[model samples]
Target: MRRPNIVWISTHDINPDLGCYAGVWPGAEYARTPNLDALARRGVRFDNAFAAAPICAPARSAIITGCFPTSIGTMHMRSKAVPPPDVRLLPEIMRAAGYYCTNNWFTDFQVDLPEIVFDDCSPEAHWRNRPTAETPFFAMFHGMATHESQLYLDDDAFAAATAHVAEADRHLPADAPLPPYYPDDEVFRTAWARYSDLITEMDHWVGGLVAELEEDGVLENTIVVFWSDHGKGMPRAKRWPNEAGLREPLIVSWPDRLPTGAGVTDLVHTMDLAPTMLALAGLEVPEAMQGVALFGGEGALRPQPNEFTFGGRDRQGEADDRSRTVRDPRFRYIRNYFPDKPAMIHTEYPDRLPTWAAFRRLASDECQQRARGELPSAMTAAQRAVVAQSKPSEELYDILADPHETVNLAAEPAHLDDLERLRAALDSWILEYGDLGAIPESDLEERWRPGGRRPATEPPEVALEAGVLSLRATTPGTLLGWTPDEPASAAEPSSFQSEIGLPAPDGRSWNLYTGPVAVGQPIWVKAWRIGFAPSDDIPVRVPVPV
Candidate 1:
């Protein structure tokens, strides 16, 4: 009767072990997604849909614009120095197409598109009040209630969340073998138990949203899709290329639109969302959109299948990282330009993970099988060396068999055919998408509160102009310097105030500020007091070239 309304619900870092997807929210007897399951029962359920980038900002960008994160230089979460003004996001398109587009608050500025989609990151972001049939709407919502390492809960909630787990729900089936690599230990189990509980909480939240939709009388006419940015934000799980990190649960529920209550195993990527929306809305998909819409009501169907979508690995330290993943329903091929550092290294050396990105804690039984494995004596030396190094430059996985992707069949003699094919395919994608490897490595974008200044180490050049020396304190902290020629001292200037906020740290350069410097004066300001560490002094010769 009406142009079907569109509602997209996205969550962060949640795997498919929940009740509606995997039963139990991966929790103890807690596949608690009755609402989602009920929704699924009425619509087409996608079994193999995936995020173009199994990450947050990247995935969000993909969904909003229907393009791969790498194609837009947005391969990693919080990587953009600033949100792009050119790329036409779906919300903008929908707005032009006469659809009201809105979202709850706090979307990263990197993905912010003015006059299209707006957010307010408060608890009330998801307030539902849409006009009935006046104009079709495309509303996107997010669930931040069950964030990783959710330690800010009230005492009672925290106690219950961290409660001990029972034995029965803690172990996998006897036939379910542990992955070749990984430890099986109480440390892993306990962490997994907590992780599951968190999922249960998220599921309960989703149920509420669904109930809201049903109550609003728009549930049936809406094209509803639910997904997560990535897997659980645990050690290797979050920032990893492994299946656990990349594998997500995607469920598409659209009643009486195309197909209903049937599982379509076709692989779908995140970026495809934008193109899909554009196509479904009877709008021409821009060539920039490297994705295609696969599901929708009238005018959404294509005569043939669209090409593959990609995922990128440019998060945190991986900023210099060049990685590309290509998948077509049957296979997933990955090429890591910097293979010297395997994903596991982040676990062994948490420092390997990006400073800006904080994954969930080590509190899950998901590692029990890995922990139980015997240490590899034949190559412990080599393995350790490899872990110390990055990963191999090339990797290929037979996803159907090794869904978890622990074994790097890249070297296996038997799968050479698939490997070469997928590798070529993955490489071709990198070229086609014009993915420049990690553009803003040192250009941090994640915002963390500026705590009091910490200690110091390296000192670079700072410049002073307009009575204010651009302190550029590495990243951002209180003003730190000495009178004229003080040997790079660290002090928190109580009187310091910045006109703008600090740029996030990409493991490099700080835009430290100094009070007011003399115009055209040669001031050597250095980053001394910092929030994390006193970083190397980055010397800047200011009086910026005009």
Candidate 2:
């Protein structure tokens, strides 16, 4: 095969807990993951893999671009991920090289504006009538079931998984190894086991996918790469720079080509996945990829990748835009960009699900009793003395000594030398990457405002009383007629209040409309934009009580 086909399978919001990572604790050995384990046994397993970001969207963007998430202005998740139109995505690069690239149902960049990314979202969700074919093929399939939102899996699956969950495991897994941030308790154990249950379910899907490829006869020649976009949604892990949140599971399999049953401990960041995959496909990695290929020996005369796997955290945990972290094999250093806020906020609770309650109750208690634990004094002092103190923003920890990351050596007299060194390294690498975040804090507001996708013509909001509906419009955009569930017709403006504009030439966009939806009747509204953003469908449920 010229260069075998490439298939990248990624799951959302999960961490490495397989036969590979040798549980952060001993109990994690049983973290049900037969499928991922099989892949590990069949190919190369990376024990030290880190994500470019500890959250979704940004990390996914980084993995596909082979650059730090911050460089693309997608440092935060969906909130700040608007890349200007000129940026070249990985798939587009594949198209240039004559590879038939395809993706199943996702492209966060295309989610908001499909036209900007996909040539067409038809034929199938995001990959059918693609533009290339002379060379090898590349396709990405997302494991949506692993998303935390689906943790509320219909009650039936929950019942089956937990049916055998011991009362001990039900209250929590047997004396679970409390991550350093948490106090040992029932809530933490129970929640972790439930989370593990979800992991098992996700793994089954991964195993099924591998089997399908084998059936298709593409298993041997294709490069199968499996990874997560980022970390699990645990308090310190999900949004913070801590390992529980930043480390990722990266399993690569190509039975006949790449070495099998070999484990590479060299530190590799998730951002490298795109470039690495492209390299495997015989494609040139663009200059924009800030990562190195796993197969390419480190970068010096005897080139070896830096000893650390790297990533950062931006506004995704309890609150936002508050914390950051840098990790190497033995250390995890955190920078509290906003130190004034409580490290443990009430918002981290995933209130609707059972798993959220388990993790929360422990993290919440940890926040409540700062005096008893082995937590550093400065952290305690900062917690008590700072009213959202943004100072003493730096922290460094020796994970080998305290994997839970309980110590703060930033202020410790002996570690100051190492701390200053890492900070300078972080700043230098950040600047060299041309990351948008390096723009001096003072100029950020001026630099980032005009790129919003809110719409050239703002949608009108409607309110009605009796038979009349009030309408408002921007100076140049007119008010068309009523479209309760569909587009409002300009010819029937008298029947309902709506703006009559040039009809949108595209099919998926929508136009707004409102009329006398009787107080006691059922109705819904769809906002339309003919050639712009996706048709926004918001269902307004109104029922008159007898």
Q: lDDT tens string, model 2, 437-490?
A: 545422443354444333433444656555345444432323222334443332
Among the numbered candidates, top TM-score falls to 2
RMSD of each predicted structure? 13.5, 13.0
TM-score of 1: 0.67
Candidate 2 regions exceeding 4 Å error are 23-27, 80-86, 109-135, 151-157, 160-172, 297-303, 346-392, 438-546
lDDT of 1 by residue, 1-546 (tens): 456677778777766665555531223144345556666676655555666665566667666666566665556555432323246556555655656666654354233222212222223434354444566777777776445655234548755753433334333333222233333444344445445555556666667677777887887777777777776665555665555566677666666665666655566665566776666556777765667677554633443244554566666433345567766655667778677655444433344333212222221222343477844343223223323346767766667766655566778899888888877777787677666444544333332122332234345345544555544433332234432332333333222111111222122212222244454533334433222343443344445666
> What's the true lDDT of residue 454 in model 1?
27
Error of 1 at 369 (Å): 21
| C-alpha lDDT score of every prediction, in listed order | 0.53, 0.58
User: Over the full model, what C-alpha lDDT does candidate 1 score relative to the true structure?
Assistant: 0.53
Per-model TM-score, in order, reads 0.67, 0.70
